[model samples]
Target: MSSSVPHAKPGGRAAAGAARAASPSIIVIGVGMKMRGDGGFGAAVIEALRAYPAVVDRVRLAACDGEPARMIDLWQGYRCALVLDAVRGGSERHGFVYRRELDPEVGDFGAQPGGTSHAVGLGAAARLAHVMDRLPGRLILYAVHGRDFRLGAPLSGPVAQAVPELAARIGREVLGALAAAAAGAGKPAKGG
Candidate 1:
């Protein structure tokens, strides 16, 4: 199954304007279900970001059901896509946030059986999209450490406490990307 995510139109003054105007744009995808304790961290980050006016109008946020296909659709057309999800990798302790280039060759992502409720695996979706020439210019995967996937309505203690730090880091990254994009466009960097 394929899906298409909507894109935001660029906004700013004409080239002749005195000041540089950066277009507000960003796509943040949080993938998880509410019942799976720490698995819901993605959604929590989205919720927190929504309350910030500075980012609310600049970023497009979506809650995905941990499905790669849906995530791909939701991220299409955005210049940058940040995927937030809970991951189970034995190398790291719970609640740790790790950022790295998504490598399809070395990870538990390959052995996972069955399509997630959303239709594909995270690694597969990204790899396929890149191979198919559909990936955004900037794609990032943020895996939040999760210890419990047990059925419940609340986040586990570790995951719950990491929300603020994660959200702040994401916000900063998004803003920095936007600024960089604007700079590359030959406009003065925003806030410079």
Candidate 2:
């Protein structure tokens, strides 16, 4: 259950060099099933990101089955991580994108049970990981509203359109984080 996601080169060889220069990495976990309609949003995002190797390398990528226990194994050791998935049952309209920054101190993730397929939601797993000291220091969840969960159905049109845009946004965030980390590392120690 070690991370098999390689250090991807977003822009190619030149980008790989840049990635090597920058530090502090981010992990992106996509949770869903490819066979299920829009429920497969997470895998879609991961697929879109695969086009950018540099981005893929900078960020650890995981396509999960919405199983909380298995997900913990993929994210261990990372300080910051982002999770992408499909969700239902919120005030948000279908195709709506939502972002939630998790607070490790919060025991209850407050995630509505049916939003995702797992018996224990991503939030509860996160809380459990927190208790076990396995949770990342900073974690963000980005959920895309799903319109269908039918087995073997293709992703709905609207959700399909959002995948590339979401991937690009995540790419920018990854680069920004790396840049910030590099800048911070270059700074002299406060006490020195």
**Best candidate according to lDDT:** 2
Where's the lowest-lDDT run of ten residues in candidate 1? 15-24
lDDT of 1 by residue, 1-192 (tens): 111233334553343122212433567888887777877888888887777776777777778786666776666566777888787655667787776554434322333322232335577778777766667656777777787777785887888888888888888888777777777999766899
Model 1 vs. true fold: TM? 0.74
Task: State the C-alpha lDDT per candidate.
Answer: 0.68, 0.77
For model 2, what is the alpha-carbon lDDT of residue 162? 83
TM agreement with the true structure for every prediction? 0.74, 0.83
- Candidate 2 residues lying further than 4 Å off, grouped into runs, are 1-24, 107-114
| lDDT by residue (tens digit), candidate 2, 1-192 | 223544555688677546434634577888888788988898899889889887866777777786777777666667788898888767777777777888778744455423874456688778778888888778888888887889999999888988998999989888888888989999999999
Return the clash pairs for model 1, or none: none
Evaluate model 2: give its lDDT: 0.77
